[model samples]
Target: MPVPVGVIEQRDDGPLRRGPRAPAWRRGAAALCAGALPALAFPAPSWWWCAYVALVPWLLLAGSAPTRGRAALDGWLGGAGYMVAVHHWLFGSVHVFIVVLGGLLGLLWAPWGVLVRSLLGGADGPPGAGRSAAALAVVPSAWLLVEIVRSWQGLGGPWGVLGASQWQVVPALRLASVGGVWLVSLAVVAVNVAVALVIVSAASRLTATVALVLGAVATGSVWAWAPLPAESGAAPRIAVVQPGIVSRAPGSPQLRFARSEELTRQVADGRADLVVWGESSVTHSLATHPSLGRRLTALSRTLGADVLVNIDAPDTDARGRHGIFKRSTLVGPGGPTGVTYDKMRLVPLGEYVPARRLLGWVTSVGRAAGQDRVAGRRQVVMTVPRRDGGSLRVGPLICFESAFPDMSRNLANDGAQVLVVQSSTATFQDTWAPAQHASLGALRAAETGRPVVHATLTGVSAVFGPHGERVGRELPTARSASAVYEVPLAQGATLYDRFGDWAVYVAVAVVAAFCAWRGLRRTPGARGGLLRRPLSAPPVPPAHTVHGSPARPGR
Candidate 1:
């Protein structure tokens, strides 16, 4: 029954066989779970270290895919999972619609998945150093493009940027100052790529190791040698008033206004330089409701400091159209300072339904804005007098605008001394939304080298110093109180403020250069006439007859 030592065996049923593949549903679930892993690295958990390796599982799953199509599917499902996980708190407001948005946005990752398969998922074996090197540069660049596209205001401004997870890390903050969040994001993705390569193939370990070392060296060099924000020796005491969630009845805005007034009165006279109230702290416009103006003037005189408050009320624009506008108005002792900044970037569904004619029915499903809020024309930096006879330049952002780095950077460049963000997450106060919203202030502060006051109505109000460090104790959702921060002013412009998103430009160049290189590699040689074969060339043989006698001229 034994076969000869040198004999070969063949089967009619099949040529070769490998292990059975995982089912589609199982693969999708794995990708989803892998994608969600990065959310834990953000606030509430604040496991900042987890972010460094959070994308590993997703990368592994995509790299080992049996086909390029399967890898693309994994990428899309994983992206959807990431979006849902990071913005899970929106479920209380948008319900199932958030998943729909997530799926639509997840499409951006399909090409990235295919790119991963092409570069790393070789059937022969683990990729060589050449492919791994290309993966290192190209993969992260592709990821950055995805982030940039999704950051549009319609899609959801930059709410949960991966670099933002490093808001609390000092070295990462330094990198942010140099290149804004884009650089930090680039570094983070590159590290993930290097780690994935090291884990998948022994041949790539050397390249991955080199990348890791170079990354560490670059980070260290920037931290040690980068220009830091110089201390201006002026510490302004900024007080933030947060009145925890009030009633939601018909007269709730009036009740919330009264609560905020009560908290403002609790602060001792002359102890604060500036008092800030949360967004929508005043329900009506001061021009129409002069009584509200008088109340704010009384508080300003009592505290011997100007009061900054947000107004959400109906107003007739120059075009005679009536709409609600969220405005940040500054109140001094004389009454209204006549200085205000209307919120330019309105929250997508929360403020207005995009393409209202088609999607207006969403209002029936949840608490989406019945009417779209009007957007402002430009940004404003108001001048306020300090207690020491000096003046302060204050830049104001209403709620969602704080998530945008360019707004704050532009304000700082335009000579704003301190950036104030008035926010209210009353709808999802009990969830992680409040904390996640608060964390953005730190990133903005680090990027602009200006202290950020993230004063909120419901809870989790916080302040970050110029270096992205917490300035004072945070006022949590359960507390209805006023806290003052002795925020230090920093001088000199950050590299990010001067250069403005240079990291993004560099990334674009890298991607473009890589594309050009690939195209050049595939082009026909200059000496060759054309890429196609000529009819004069010998005809190709069939796979079954490769080893048979060679064909003669006409055989």
Candidate 2:
């Protein structure tokens, strides 16, 4: 057997692993590479399988650290890489503050790296399969905890979650039904740990192989045996109107109206049961603006179907003159239907500035759009009038709102048979943002066990079945036109919809258990396996003779 490589721990300022360690710059670069490697698994490049091994380098670096502080630095730098790579699109909008966001967000992983070093740094851990298995389980669990915490909307929302990288992976998408994205994330992290274990324990390769095999088996089993969604009702014919219009700064009112009107008419010419226009397609509301409302009313009558459009307009209530509210309203053949859904979740910097009082100084970084948009209070499940007989229950979300999982989940739970995402990604059409935004429909569909229609303004308009399989050809980004699709309706809630975020709870439990285990190890008598630190020097032997006299030097 190969000699067991000893892990060195430097309690004092000394050489690491019996030698001078590499310079801090080299180590920092390694950490950054570890963090950024996973970005390839996301959109644009979209190397989906890369997520399974993306964390290996960073994890190995953290585990090799001679001290917890060093390990934390390693993890932080790695996290900074991930944050910067995943959200680089923010650079166009947030400007230099993208660096600030990455730096701040990267801090979330420092303690995580410290924990990895503390538990699996191999100081006290014996060279055996047990340690390998523990690493395989514990590393992913800890990562799940980090992903869950980082996903909190206040930080940045769940933009490029690890599991989301597997949007195209059928097995991974199936796992999402039972545990949400957290389950898939856990599986991916475990796979990475297994790969690391195999490399670290060349002498004891069987354990590592077992871990890798088990991960594959579990993933395959989920894909083969997981529940599939059942069709709940009749299919609805949906047509998306892409005006091929680009807006840099909301140029002109008449121009916007005419464009939306002409394009919608072209698509809605009695072709489908419902017609969709991208977010803010109708700059004014039918309720407030009569001229715009009259034209839509005539169009709806001519089409003999319901016309759905988004409106961003100011509303005056009893409280005071509040900011503009953006909502989607459905127009009936006769006139305006009161059925409407307001966007619940608002974009942080794009829609409104957060902490306007303290950090309001960021106006110099990006073009500051005056007046924030107000958010809606509750979920709205609109019963859209169909060309057939009974109406189809649909839950509509605006551009940025689709990113929030709860928005879709709440809609599904509230009797929404189909999920519709209306977006205008003209701002980042040329970039990866449009495709990334459109792909979220797959996850939402799998999670809620409902068909999802991602109808966008420019392009990348796609549809997914209840099980997240792509329904038809996805319209590419940066292009525009009218595309008609027959969206299938599915019934019955998945385990995720019924028991929401079970995977997150599992992650929390795993984290709590790991913390408790670490605490137990630090206790006075905790064995701590092979990494046990000597509390005091081994008892000094008395220099004595056999007859109780001082022993000689040879004795």
Candidate 3:
């Protein structure tokens, strides 16, 4: 009896004895660091490579324990690290209050770890093909779900979605045409899953390697064979100005007027057919202030080109209700026709704090404090004269509005030949915000199958062609400068622009079906039997054990 009981006990603890249990805090710390690795890789541009391996340690640790609570904790740790690191630039604008914001934002990761652990199972057992398949499909879906949720009105808009990390990767960017940014994100998650499988299971090593190789091959093949929009003609010459004005400065309005004058002078003597200024170039109302309109009209005529100027000012509607219109006004060789495209998507806090009555105190400090800019309700496309005597329609996105895929797609659907983003990044100076903001234009360009010009205060101003390739010149964040480039105006629609994010909705449905199936199959007395018992369950002894002698332990 003693021998039998001892053998059972030994068998129960055998797998546990193979390795020391990692401390909760250590595992949490490792997860945090792992999540942050990819973000630190920013600025260098090569840092995106870290994304492939960054989540491995966190995944491994989550697999080690395999409990729902543990997984949530691990995910929270990792998410906190990733969000804090990537958005550290927020601190530059928000100051020490960022500590609270970072911690609050870290909450986004909790479910990620839980999902990963559930998909992988505990470290002692192998995740079978069923689990592997679910992981391959569900992980990326979960990420997209989270991104969509976080892109709400009050939460931060889509700033650093994983798909944006591959901004410079041409092949991955092509995936945007098929499924918006979700496809690229899925591909990345799939790669990470393959890598995790290879690391964990020796028998599945060859299988994992094949999966990884095939995924790469698939991505590469699509990139090489993807049908791109045909080049219509030589790109129209355009110039963008970065005046680098601080919004709160007493002389900011005057300074912007002077900079606009100078940029117009430069374009007038140059070969530019169109010139663009950053958002709020005229920080006064053009309709109410005739002098401002006169200056823009003179500039457009002097430059002999259509000049797109962003105006941030208050205007009264037909009902005489006073409201602000952050608009893009096109001044051509003719004059200002009062034709304008007001910004649709407004940045929370930065534009107008949600629940302003309750959180009004939040606006008393930091970069966006005391600002009460109103949002526009329409998605209007502004038409300007092309240098070739043809009219070029532009979809104008003000600042944070450019980050939304649907917004840009709608603009293209509205017959916009070019996507123009007028932005102000001076508040986030020298941070990844500008680069991240600039990167989205590439994705938008791909999604819409149209060239996009991002003109910003501070820098990272650039032009992306219909193929999502950077054309013309790009200015770094360190300088107050200008760039002129020819951007081809392509007419047509991309599959994504036409169809929208139907793939994402399909994926969501699939994930829902999977979760429901798993839940039903795991129900008591189901045909497939229950999932493996909890880790704390006692182990059973081998049957062919000798009496009176110590029996061998079960694996």
- Number of the top-ranking candidate, with TM-score as the measure: 1
Each candidate structure's count of clashing pairs: 0, 3, 1
lDDT of 1 at 513: 89
Question: TM per model?
Answer: 0.91, 0.90, 0.88
Error of 1 at 482 (Å): 0.4
Computed on alpha carbons, the lDDT of every model, listed in order, comes to: 0.86, 0.77, 0.74
RMSD of each: 5.6, 5.4, 6.0
Ranking by lDDT: 1, 2, 3
The all-Cα superposition gives candidate 3 an RMSD in Å to the true structure of 6.0
Residue 185, model 3: lDDT of 71
CA lDDT, candidate 1, residue 523: 32
lDDT of 2 by residue, 1-555 (tens): 222357443443222465566889999998988899999998888899888888888877887787778988988998899999898877877888888888888988998887666545635433366666666677788787778777876677888888888988888888888888778888888888777666665643688788778778887888777676787667788877776555445575456566767766776553688888778777765657887888988988877788888888876423454658777888887777877777767877777778888777776678544567888777788887777677888899888777777778889999988888898777676777877888888988998888888877677788898888898788787555677787888877787888888777776777788678766766364343423454334446678877898887875
Task: Return the clash pairs for model 2, or none.
Answer: 124-530, 124-531, 232-491
List the candidate 1 regions with Cα displacement exceeding 4 Å. Answer: 1-19, 317-321, 523-555
Where model 3 places Cα greater than 4 Å from the true spot, the runs are: 1-22, 44-46, 245-249, 317-320, 525-555
Q: Which one wins by TM-score: 1 or 3?
A: 1
Model 1, global lDDT: 0.86
Q: What is candidate 1's lDDT per residue for 1-555, written digit by digit as tens?
A: 333455332222111124456688999999989988889988888888888899988988888776667788999999999999999998878889999988998888887887777677734347899989998999888888888999999998887788888888999999999999989998898899899999988999999999999999999999888887887977999899998877878998889899998889887553888999999898888889999999999989989999999999997644565779898999999999888888999999999999999999888888899989999889999999998999899999999999889999999999998999999998897888888889999999999999999999988899999889998799998988998889899999899999999888888888888878766654366235222222233445543435675555654
Query: Whose lDDT is higher: candidate 1's or candidate 3's?
Result: 1
